[model samples]
Target: MAGSRFVGHIKMWFFFVPLLSVALMPAAPDPSLFDIPDAEAASVASSLGEVRTADAIDTTNRTFKHYFVATGLVQASMASSGETQIEDGGVANFASRWVHNFWRLVYRMVYRITVMKYWLLGMLVFGIAMFTDGTVRRKVRAAAAGYVSPLSFHLAGHGILLVFGVTFTVLIAPLPLIAPYWLAIAACLGALLWKAASTYQ
Candidate 1:
């Protein structure tokens, strides 16, 4: 009877051992590409002014790390598959067999002549708007000594550029060429503006 009791206890221990081991195991560390240094974090906060508070700075830093890890995985996978090639300073590869070097050359030439110019202009406008908004928000927050929602700043900056972008497309480009994409961009801009305005108020 003692031997049998001992055997039963052994069986119970054997069954519970894995559970205890699993419970005791350390959790896996987060796969972050890099930590945001204090100086860099402070710089970002300073640049964004009052639009991004300390909490927002931390959130942005974390988000950036997550984005880096996710994009790094995707880039690695693409490289492994030969779908993308890492050249001198940039990525190069065709997504489909139909997209060859000749087509890419022609596309690039056209882009440089047309799309690239407008895109650069749009970017410049957006950057200026962002700087202005950040400056304004920072001044307001400093004066009030209260947190200001970043949403409005982002919306105002993005919305103005998006409006210009859509207008440029409609006025300069063919409707058939821009129709499919214009609505999506317009909707996104509108939604962002609405959310930002609502949040700010």
Candidate 2:
């Protein structure tokens, strides 16, 4: 009874969402809603605390870098040992270069991670859903198998992407929301919820 009731609610959504979208067809949101200029990428970064960085250092000075200094110390040790043999010097030089490159790579990776920390965090949420008991994965995969024909499959695939892309862009980015956008989002949500409910049956 509860599953049927849930499905009934989903069906109701299918009706109401389209009705609401049609009602909104004549006009987009008022300018007061879309006029916020600070809703750009900078604001997103600021909200994630990425834009508020530590004081800038003298990046031009390569020798001042920890990686470079570490390699320099290795080279100095080689020279101080009076090891003039070509083979031994070559090994030391190779080790120094390897250490230098490794640390430099680590530093760059860390810097980029800090810049995109919020993006990574958001993706991890999706990752958790994807890797969990496989309910979401199984439902989507079963739905995928139902799209047999090339035209139907590809069209549905692209339509799903377009709906999600448009919804996300309008919601997260500073963009004008349109009626068709809401219709698309609602239709997708209704269909997915209906499919999920049918699984319980």
lDDT of each: 0.41, 0.41
Query: Which runs of model 2 end up more than 4 angstroms from their true locations?
Result: 1-50, 53-89, 124-201
Please, what are the lDDT tens digits per residue for candidate 2 over residues 37-132?
343334433444453433111231333355556567645644554424577746555544444443333333333333334344544454344335
TM-scores of the candidates are 0.25, 0.27
Candidate 2: RMSD to truth: 20.2
What digit string (tens of lDDT, one per residue) describes model 1 on residues 53-101? 4545455445544654456753453444354444623223333221232
TM-score winner among the candidates?
Answer: 2
lDDT of 2: 0.41
In model 1, what is the error at residue 65, expressed in angstroms? 40
Residue-pair clashes per prediction, in order, are 0, 0
